[model samples]
Target: MTHLFSKLSLYNSARYPANAARPLLEIHVLQPRQVFTLAAATALAPVAIDLYLPSSVGMARELGVDAGAAGLAVSVFLFGLAAGQLVIGPLSDRVGRRPTILGGLACFILAAGVASQANSLPVLLTARLFQALGACSVLLSSRAMVSDRLDPPSAARLFSMLSLIGGAAPVLAPIIGALLAELGGWRACFFFMAVFGFTVLTAATVLLPESRSAETSAAARSESPVEAYLTLLKNREFQLYLIAGGANGAAFFTYLGNSASVFQDVYGVSPFAFSIMVALNAGALVWANQINRRLLKQHSLLAVLRMSGRNAGLLAAAFALMALSGVTALPLLLGLVFLMVGSVAPVQANTLASVMGIGRARAGSAGALLGAAIFALGALASSIAGYFYDHTARPLTLVTAVFLAITSLALG
Candidate 1:
């Protein structure tokens, strides 16, 4: 890990000397442990959301609500995540990354604890929203910290690295949730999330370094969030990149909102089997992210985005056709979903790098906007898919295909 960081550091120094003046938390080289810590922090929201997915139906039954209302919990969480990023992103720039993250983690811990005790749909939804809000702080700040430390290309790689680490959350979270739900109940999932949040908070408080210096913090404070956002919005390239990234994210969100119901309720798969299926898709995503990191070494980011966007579109179309044709086989549908969703990493990584590159001085704001856009679109997609649930995967596939088509057009 030390050797890899040195190589990346040397490459960045040679490729972009301007980055030499940037305030990095690590003075010499970034340690692998630091990367893992930051990545884990960023994974909080996804882990929290995914960890409870397998228990959504059970939660609804226990809470005496409809499945749609249960699914609304996921959408509400995404909305909170979007809202939080809008606030936390700029706040991190003004106050520094470390404090912003710790503050967010604290909120997440409290929210998770609240959620564990929730006996009604409204209370559970509210708690999930707060949990998302807290997690977004860590998510946005982690990206900004990477931008603060690395140049555009290296930052892109770091984003891919973070995704690689985060991808595991989907794979493992559901399995854990399944076991807990089976052994204890849906509430046990929330209790586990609370404990996880507390652990991450402690680790971040002790190990995470502050990337934004006092000077940068002061300068960031001088500008209002509105002004910063306005300036970023004026950049056409950034807007394009944001749309492309958001579109791909929307596809993933569509899947997340509908997959559990489609696999478990519609297809009659057991919770354990459903967890394994989800893990398989997440494994594919992780593999694709690793491939994206490798591709970055030999190709331009835009080139990678264009290629990924095209491939994702093709895969989504194939999946849509399969769904519409009444083909409900688990293995076939899962394989198509794997390729289509896995294609997101390259497009997202490059688009984010482009967005942050345009506003190097305000990377936090850029990251916030990017994060907000992704989750906002995600919330929209999830809500639409969940509302139109027809006891099949068609709704999910159709929404995913539309988003993939949009992503392809945006990349072009």
Candidate 2:
């Protein structure tokens, strides 16, 4: 039987003269198809997470639920996403990446359909949970696939790009969802997501080459799953990265959970305008990623961590100060939010990779745990943010600042 995880020849994306030794500054090496598949697969989760943001208010209105109650749908979805990874990661270890991903995609599509037709808040929230459960496969498999095939340096570069692509969805999803909502209402947004999921599912069947082997997976399966997890948990570095990544994940969820209220209710911005703010914030992430790539050429991953940690701490302080100053103006809040997330976003990929670099077999489980911790904490943050959602920016900014500060301390 063929082993799909076997390393392929390095496909160099750059060429230089024999004497040229400087690292290439640009990332044109990932083939068009590789980029597309990775982007689609990895980006699906963020898209699922954010695509409903703009529709949250509409869904609440249509379902006759309060905004806080409707926000439970988002929280439930994230809860499912976090829970799904715990099982899916190990299952992928047993089955293979391709089967895991395909199965998850199928489930996600079904959930989307259910969500589109949901008649009540309970039904919608339930469907969103299932939707999140299915979407986890897409993210886990993509990261696992990269780990299986790419060398460390190449893996870092590709994963950075993957993070960038993943970030783009949140950057644009609110706008996209808002546009759909404006045209045909909240249900129409689900229809759009369903179409996107279906398209990706079809593409995966045709385009995604299998990257893990059944025989190896089967052999590994012979070991006790408990032992496997315990072994990974024993790794000290993995703990560090997990905590670091989880901190940022917490911060991100804080943003997601509070952005709508902060923008519309606190600052009196329109939904369209709020989406623009999200775009700007996400755009900062993209810029940070670019900077991260450049720093890779000159600094070790640890060096990057130190920088990111400090920056996160500084921004968190800024958030706290901003919240206390009673400056709920859109421009002031936007600038602060952008600064806080901008530096934190790019460092996340490196944080995960540093801790999980032992070998490929553990990547899925590790990434899953990392993701689970982040999102689980994020869900907690979301709940807290929502609970404290007075018509002020203080709750949101205070949460962001606190998370960043805590993360910095932990990472430091």
Candidate 3:
């Protein structure tokens, strides 16, 4: 979309390349129509990230890089996610969510195109950084919109739904990524990503409303970003939930950064088998979300968070012990892995809802910081896990266990 023209003058350069003057079709913003759309929009992050998991080894081999460097791609994406949210979240409060997120989607599409053509690891990693920035924009915007419309209870249910939807992305991501990698190689993944980005952008451009109200924009403008960040930082409750979320997020990221390597390299699983295993395990998350939603009826938010944290901690610790014992049986590790991923739902959703409640007035900013904490902590943990890779799952499992303990301590 080129905005050289006024509201009526905007045209999609992607659609009508021969005529830059062609008007883009306007889809009136009927926001209730975007309910599933918004949740789907948030799925792009996992789609972008996990959709390439199976392709990492192929990508590394083609680029003449080692496994660690290839794994660092995930860490790189997390860093960009953290940085992007920190910059875009507060800005959305002032400028409005739609434009900020649309800009991000454009960046994502461009980066995916660049990644498809990248010949070196550096080029690919650079492209991934911008892609994460784009992903965070959608994620932050979608979360802010939820905050705009819902109270804590309702927000939790919606977030649970998001988890249920997002978990499906990983189920599909691995299968598609492996198939694409086999047929057309790793570059195919990026091609798919570019197409996905364009579709999301079009839908968002048409369906997304300006969720940031004029008064909130004015209020946001009253303070500098530094002061706005400081205000949130001074609140201890926000800090507690932020750390809790970050640690839990780190645990998940650690699993992601190393899971492929451990399964494919150590266990000698075929790419096809690996894809099915990942997909089946992902169902745990969907199941967990439904359980979480129901439990919210019987228990308090914090109570759910504590239970999830405790369960996740046990799962991670069990994974580490199994790895240390040289257990390579797919059934044992896969079951443990399923439980670990499942336990992520309540902790992440509840902690996130609690923080958003604390900073609802600054939803954009609060969402940004919370997202940043998760990604930043995740990047650090994943990088650390990648560094210690020893052709075994120990590195990933141990790191997940340590981070989940940190999360459990916060919940305690």
Candidate 4:
């Protein structure tokens, strides 16, 4: 709730630690193919966010529980992701990126295997929690890896590409899950996730180079978890960016958590049809992501933020007005939805680059804290959206509109 913008001046002169440790291999060490592989590894955890969405309804029937409670499993995973990132982010800084990610991937694989075997709702939920914990390494460390090896401008460009892949995965996963479920069953989705995690684990072990520099500055060397957090808390712009980012994430989670019921119970649409809607949003985001890359080349990161933040605000306001006027036609709503989500990747990548750019010596910590905060915000949003599931799309529209308003204010 604190105003992060007020503290912007405090970090204006901040710089990456000149004495920071270096990567074992230079950024120039890897081929383009290897970089893409690493990027894919980093994106898998985000893919997990929506990979299971198409299966939520089927999962409820199989687990003998109501859909809402089964939906809680997704929220639980988010909680784990938030909490795990908090630890892994700081831990990676203390030790190294490789160890933390490898450990997390191992746990993720174990959890997926366990989830695939779960026969009851509670067991399944617990398995998902662990799965999120494991996935955190991939999510958090991937960013840290790039931050460690590349300068801010280069990192921003790389992150844009990473955002593209991460955004695409979630958008496409539902389609995959729906097809697999229609052919196999809900359990098959988890099985596929396990296999995917295994592939990432293998790739990470083979391709991920260590990146903790031995020449880290005094601040980097002396920073404890407490100090890392205290620094972020006291910084105004960081807090503002964090809140905006988290609110945006909550909006996404609102869509994700409630999609099953919204698609099936409300619209009476098949999973495949629902996935097409999701894909449309993702495609819009992909286009937006590419635009951001071009914009970044021509403008400062701040310019991108101002453009995206304002544009998203205007669009979200329009959507809210339409919903308020009871324009509930499916095409109208889907068009609004796609427009709202279009800003997601651009806004997130820019905000993250801005926030982490300020804490060059401790980007891992910055990334971890931000990731956790967004997940917490997302869990809260998911819970609220789930509560208002009246077999209508109104709940999603209302929640997303609220988040957009909050983000607009925060960004301003």
TM-score leader = 1
> In model 1, which residue pairs have backbone atoms overlapping below 3 Å?
none
Q: For model 3, where is the 10-residue window of minimal lDDT?
A: 1-10
Q: How accurate is candidate 2 locally (lDDT)?
A: 0.75
The Cα local distance difference test for each model comes to 0.84, 0.75, 0.80, 0.75
Please give the distance, in angstroms, between residue 210's alpha carbon in candidate 1 and its true position after superposition.
1.2
Question: What local lDDT does model 2 show for residue 354?
Answer: 63
Candidate 1's C-alpha runs over 4 A off are 12-24, 213-219
Candidate 1 overall Cα lDDT vs. reference?
A: 0.84
Clashing pairs in 2: none
**Residue 393 lDDT in model 1?**
85
Model 3 lDDT, full chain set: 0.80
Tell me the tens digit of each residue's lDDT in model 1 across 143-258.
88887766677788888888898788888998999999998888999999889888888888888878885555775878999999999999888888889889889898888877
TM-score of 2: 0.90
